[model samples]
Target: RRSVRHAYCQLCDEAFRSQDTLRMHLKGEHQDRYCDTCDQARLLPSSLFGSDYALKEHHVQSPRHAYCQYCDRHFRTHEVLRQHYREHYVQSPAHAYCQRCNMHFPSGAALFDHYRTMHY
Candidate 1:
């Protein structure tokens, strides 16, 4: 029998086998201390409340951030908005819209069948 040891992240309580993996976890999961909207631009930790305020400001001002008034939701990209639309509105029985060819289906089953037959 072999016993394997894993390096665990104290901040997120997740385990990894390597220091590089742990470092990546810390950067991605725990360190939200940079503005993602600004292409991971570095911020000064000594400033007022660090980068959280900058991230919020960027989200508010950036045109890339899209807002859905109907759902009161925000998306980072238009592609994400399209995905949200398809998931929430188009996939619903009342409004079935085909994602592939931009066709409208009367029902979700019809859309699924169309995808299975035409797409698949």
Candidate 2:
């Protein structure tokens, strides 16, 4: 990579060996005239001209597609929305009698124990 000899500020015509030094000069010297954000100064030798600041601003301000009134949060999918709503309620697995042996149990654990003792 070639070193930058002298960078001239288009606004003030001041010259420096580095672009960082020029940016500082522009930020400090002409704060009222320059509209760019000075806090995030770029030092790399690439064009700052290609960045899209408006798109970033739009994404931050826009409302999300899925919104939950219960949790007061936004999700991107239906499964996520359903799972989030379940957090407020207690969930238990439904159980029934095993058709093969006519053994009855209210929960899976009880059914497994009954089957193991009676059949196996």
Error of 2 at 32 (Å): 1.2
- Estimate the TM-score for candidate 2: 0.27
- Alpha-carbon TM-score of each model against the true structure: 0.31, 0.27
lDDT scores of the candidates, listed in order: 0.60, 0.50
10 residues in a row with least lDDT, candidate 2:
87-96
Clashing pairs in 2: none
Off by over 4 Å in 2: 1-4, 38-120
